[model samples]
Target: MTVEFAGEYFPIQPGGRFVVGREGDLSIDDNLFLHRHFLEIAESGGLWWLANIGARLQATVTDATGGVQAWLAPGARLPLVFATTSVVFSAGPTTYEFTIHSSEPTFRETRREREVEGDSTIGEVPLTLSQKQLLLALAEPLLRRDGTGMSAIPSSADAAARLGWTVTRFNRKLDNVCDKFDRIGVPGMRGGAGGSATNRRARLVEHVIASRLVAKADLTLLDVGETDPADAE
Candidate 1:
């Protein structure tokens, strides 16, 4: 197996364990949310698994269904069931993203093989200016702050206020943006009706940031001095 990080790839031998964290076999120092030994990947009984070793942090795992399957807290383990899986977590002041890949047979691999046989092409969807602005606001809470205090993820209302919109208006627009992404084949953007509102918002923010749909330069669009009359409460 092969593990890729920061444009570098490391080969993992079959049945050999690969440790990933700030001070593990794969040292990921870019994010402080990672522990000394945050995660371990290994093949056991002919199946690959990912285990979480962080004491406090939880890893969000998105399944083939494009919804969160589990929050892998300390002592938790999840099967690597897909050809590629996205893992996200927040710690301290930063959110981290990791992708796990497998060379063995998996649902995603089967789907890709079918696509290749059929010669299918996936197209990209363009974001409108308004959608771009909304994405920027949704991502603001995760961006680095300037003050000396401990970083905190902002509430939906706080993010709305930053964009000069009421929470209700912001949520309505957020739903619309999520629907747009869903129609465009973006994973993890669509939320189920059962989860807590806070979790849904967090998932949306994670998806937006992880997908690179929003960036620091896009924040400039949020600085528009005037608010839309329709967005005013």
Candidate 2:
């Protein structure tokens, strides 16, 4: 198996293991928010498994196309089943990503894109144009990034400013979007009535990318800026 990050690749022998974190076989950034040894990649039972060794952080695992996803929380592990598996996680205000390449993959993508029926339903999650714009603002940096480099998820205020709106307006729109996602049972989206604000932005972005809820094509919304929901129709 091989790991790709920032245009660099590292091959992992079946007998050996690779560690990813602030300091490990693959040393990441110097951010104090990250664990010294966070994620562990090892071969078990003839399959490569990616495990989250950290107690706080969780990883978003998906196929290269982002059609399938799995959350790898602490103490949980997932097998690298795709030919190219991508893992995304958030540490502090920054989001990090990496890709695992297996010479022999157990699954391959065979599904193709179908026509859209009505509102913007990204993976069956209906989104309004305004909500889509909100997501584009939150996901702009991540969308612009290439390879496996770390990207900072903008703060709500920053994202609001990016969209030329007041913080209150941004938060309102955020609540609406989160509510829609919760209705469809998207995990970690945010529970109604009592939901903490911490990590909500990061988790949203992580899930959006890993679940293929948003893609680069949506980044054009950032340039279009804020718009009326009716105008997009």
Candidate 3:
């Protein structure tokens, strides 16, 4: 098996364990928000396992097709069953991602029916074109990134400017989008108790990308504004 980040690859020997974080075998970065040893990958029981060892941070695991996804919370472990497993997470203001390729994967991608309805959605809650534009603005950096690696999440103001919108307009849209997701049982979208708006944006980006709700194809929405209206209501 091999792990990839920024085009560099690290091969994991059979039965060997590898650690990843701010200070681990992968040493994701020197960011203080990242744990010293966040994720551990090991060959156990004739299978590869991905475990979350960090107390504060969580990782998003998905298959190569992004059709299957799981949240790896602290102490959680998942089998590396897919031919390629992509891991994504956020630490502080930056988001990092990497891919794990297994030479002997147990599971393979096949046609699967859509579990949720709508062209873009969460639990049947469809995303408006305007909301999609907001997401594209926020996710532009990550979409433009070269490979599996770290990218800086744009601030609300920066994202707003990218959409050719005023801060007030941008903030209002952001509030609406967050509120929509929050109502649909999505966590970390609310402020005050959950986290600050800054943290919320990072979580939003992490979830959307991990779930394949937004892709590079959606980035073009920025060029042509959403016709849905200022107030989607």
Candidate 4:
């Protein structure tokens, strides 16, 4: 299906489908493109789910378990806010209900399904596959720059600019990266600023040292535990 949202065309499914834009038309793989788009939305802001096309038309997600997820898909021309769940959507017969689940979205397949006895529900909807992809893509560069000599955090805006993104988009990518890092227990993401920077630097040094030792492990002349004066010189 060819879906048009906010005057832009995006491929809805697999085929020789493309989304024509000012820069150029992009061929989209529905399974993969949504994930990438979600990241793009996140990079522009900490959250991308709010910007979904289904957020508008006063869409409400009600699962059989009575879980209510409400959001507004406001057009992209408006300013950002938390008041409404905004989505830029195509003019289609919007389906307020879906069989989608968060577990079926991305790499979160391990999510355990819960059954409410009477009605134990939360007001959260199933996140799109696009959103998941966005998160994964955001984690890559940030993770690369997190360990060893790359421990220093870079300006997300600068990185976004290099990728032809606006400043807003860059910040969103940084937020997604941080969230992923926290989930994976990479450390340093949630520490005090001054201490965190110092700790990361120290870890980087240790990592480099360990790597060097491993590289020269075959050379008996260079011992990892030795502190010989002759070897130092």
Best by TM-score: 3
- Candidate 1 achieves a global lDDT of 0.68
- Model 4 alpha-carbon miss at residue 27, Å: 50
Candidate 1, 28-101: lDDT as tens digits: 77566558888999888778889997798877776534533466888999888776676767666556656777
Higher-lDDT candidate of 1 and 2: 2
Instruction: Put down candidate 3 lDDT per residue, 1-233, tens digits, no spaces.
Output: 99999888999899899999988889978989999999999988888999999999988999877778899999999999998999988787677889999888899667767668656544555777778888988888888874333347778899888977888888888888888788877788888854487778877887788878888887877888456554343
What TM-scores do the predictions have? 0.57, 0.79, 0.81, 0.22
Candidate 3 wrong stretches, greater than 4 Å: 113-122, 146-152, 193-195, 227-233
For model 1, give the 10-residue run with minimal summed lDDT.
Answer: 144-153
lDDT (C-alpha) at residue 224 in model 1: 68
lDDT of 4 by residue, 116-135 (tens): 58853342222223222222
Error of 3 at 152 (Å): 4.2
Candidate order (TM-score): 3, 2, 1, 4
lDDT of every model, 2 decimals = 0.68, 0.80, 0.83, 0.30
Q: State the lDDT at 32 in candidate 4.
A: 23
* Alpha-carbon deviation at 158 in model 4, angstroms: 1.8
Off by over 4 Å in 1: 30-33, 63-68, 108-136, 140-168, 171-204, 207-233
Give the RMSD in angstroms, all C-alphas superposed, for model 4: 21.9
